[model samples]
Target: MKLRKLITVAMACIMVFSLAACGSENTQEDAAATETTTEENKAEEVEETAEALSGTVVITGSTSVEKILTDMIDEFTALNPDVTIEYTGNGSSAGIKDTKAGINNIGASSREVKDEEKEDTLAEEVFAYDGIAAIVNPANEVQDITMQQLSDIYTGKITNWSEIGGADAEIFIVSREESSGTRSAFEELTGVAEAGGLTSSAAVSEGNGPVQAAVAGNENAIGYVSFSFIDDTVKALKVDGVEPTAELAKAGEYKLSRPFLFVYYEDKATDAGLAFLEFALSEEGQICVEDHDAITVD
Candidate 1:
């Protein structure tokens, strides 16, 4: 009887060990399966997001915002190759109209949305800030200008370059079309809007590129353009003794800055449209903005 009892105890012990070993193995297998499932789910989520973001997004708006937008688009598309973005350099007013009418997925603007343009369905995001630089040909010696002086120049009061300490020549005024957001913002900032708008005789360019080109080729011409558009061919004048740099604009030391906006109809925007808009506001997108000489929204 003692032998039988010892044998029974040994067998019971063996059975217990076998059960524990099996449980341990099963637990490890379960853990591995769970980890694999988690990884697969994460991948699926990423794939879904990418899939949803694949579509065409049409953007139209201010010529002032075009260069920065292009830079942002290049960065954004690198991360999302499946997305397509088309941009047209129409005036800000046309952009607003297109966005409002659902003709475009997004509208770019260098000016604030006017009260008359606001609606419940329409939404706008400030993607960046830009300074309107009063540019002159590099050959011109005018280095700085006061707001009052700029106002006078645009209003046809200061027609002679000598009136503002520059060389003796008739100031050839280069102005933007009435629908241009840059023009609206520049005029408002310089108090030219209140002084009866840009002078009627000023040569009007339809886009920033044209304005820059006209100024770059004419030594007597003076025009304003987005800071992003400034290049070696043109010299940007200091406004009110403050240099028009992104740093100064962000610090509020430069007074000629305005908001760069993305306008869209909230309810009608495509997934890709919303995604692109958010991307432009993201930290990475802001880096692209700064890289192109525009200030980030932050």
Candidate 2:
């Protein structure tokens, strides 16, 4: 009978230990679930905070940067649907002036801002680098031209195609308009920024597209345009034995290159403007720069 009682007590102790083990397991499981819930809640809060940021951003600047910036803006707006962005492709100098006058939220320039053009209130952020391609008609037999030869041809010093190993036809110089950012960059890089640098007789187009079309349609025409615009329509010449490309530009091997800048007035920047700038300088925006065939700052 004592043995029977002892056996019953042992069974009771076993039940108590089993219950304690089960309870401990349940407590650990509950703690794990709580941690997972806390992490999920934090994630949801971050998503909500990102979605809450919404506003309008206005950008005005160089037509040279218009295409890339437009693509970036489209991507950025897809995430921040309520954030509005408007871009105007005025000349770079005009954009800078407008930004200074509070007419624009941000100013885009294909070239670095000149010291004389910058104000104490303004800040320059270079987002990308662009290579200026010297283009010619696809039919042109000229495969390469030195930088000095290009400068001479544009300046009317070398007016004949035969002077650069092509046919004996007269070289038609197609140039961008005076206010074009491409023109400013081209002139500066080619050492033609001095007075009467570009030939007054050259056919002047207003935008990069027009310049490309003009060169593409004329067999004897030579022009310079943004590297992104060069395709089968025109042949890009090797300057000083190096082809103008984004990689060469980034490596400083391409001479006809310039920075793509975002100029803003720090004091005048709004919350939307600041957010947009952050997005532009982000990795995603840099990817857009590469997608557009320009070199990212990084």
Candidate 3:
């Protein structure tokens, strides 16, 4: 009876060990399956990113550039169908301020960094070359003028179309407001001292389109805007015997030419910001520049 009892005890112990081994195998299989599922989930997330784009891109500054971006956005949207672009016609200074404060994703500037504004960790990328033009109403007989004359008119030294050339009418010195990037660029070219001061007898408008419209609407009006803004309604005058043109501007023959740049946070190298900026500089994007009546770098 003792031997039989021992035999039963041994058999029971063997059964327990066999059950534990089976349980271990099942646990290992479950862990492997779980790992495979986790990997699949990670792959699905990547595929989703590849399949669709969804984000709002805010670009602000240089109404002149904004003109081009509006059309670019139309084309970009057609291709992307998922990304949305929003642009504002704020001046370069205002745009840069917004960029620094994290209010805007991209800031369009017509010139390089200023002394104080350079303190931020933002990055700048030049996408196009821009030349500014002296715009006059199409009805005005004066087709061309010199930098000296333009400076004189802007400084309130010359106040009539007759003072320069055209009809004997009061020349409304229409211009962008003091906060304008275009104005800053003009000031840099003509020498601020020659321009008198920010407070001149000129009529300052809120934005570039207004400046363009004001000149186009009034027969005796004169203003300065980007060469791109010179359309059928207004005439672009020469500066120092040089026309504000792409070719002339590139050779430095055009004195008022400047670079159109895109400003962003310094991390632009590794963000969606890089993609848009790359597109802006791409061959296809450069082609779109003319759609808005502007010149492209390439």
Segments of candidate 3 deviating more than 4 angstroms: 1-49, 193-195, 268-270
What value of lDDT does candidate 1 attain over all alpha carbons?
0.92
Off by over 4 Å in 1: 1-29
Q: Rate the local accuracy (lDDT) of all candidates.
A: 0.92, 0.88, 0.78
Off by over 4 Å in 2: 1-34, 37-41
CA lDDT, candidate 3, residue 162: 83
Clashing pairs in 2: none
- The digit string of per-residue lDDT tens for model 3 on 1-298 reads 9999999999999999999999999999999999999999999987675455557788888776776777667766676666777898778888888888888888988766688998557888887777888888878898778877777777777777887778999888887776578888887787654556543567888877788899999998888888777789888887777767877877778888777888888664334455678778888788877565455876
Q: Decide which is better by TM-score, 2 or 3.
A: 2
Q: What TM-score fits each model?
A: 0.90, 0.87, 0.77
Q: In TM-score terms, which candidate is top?
A: 1
Candidate 1 per-residue lDDT over residues 102-213, each given as its tens digit: 8899998889999999998788899899999999999999999999999999999989999989899999999999889999999999999999888887999999899999
Task: Give model 2 RMSD, 1 decimal.
Answer: 3.1
Candidate 2 local lDDT, 1-298, one digit each (tens):
9999999999999999999999999999999999999999999997886777778888987888877898889988898888899999877887888888889999998887888886787898988889999999999999999878877887888999999899999999999877678888888888777635998879999778998999999999999988878899999999999977899889999888998989998888877788788888899998888987899988
Lowest lDDT block of 10, candidate 2: 187-196
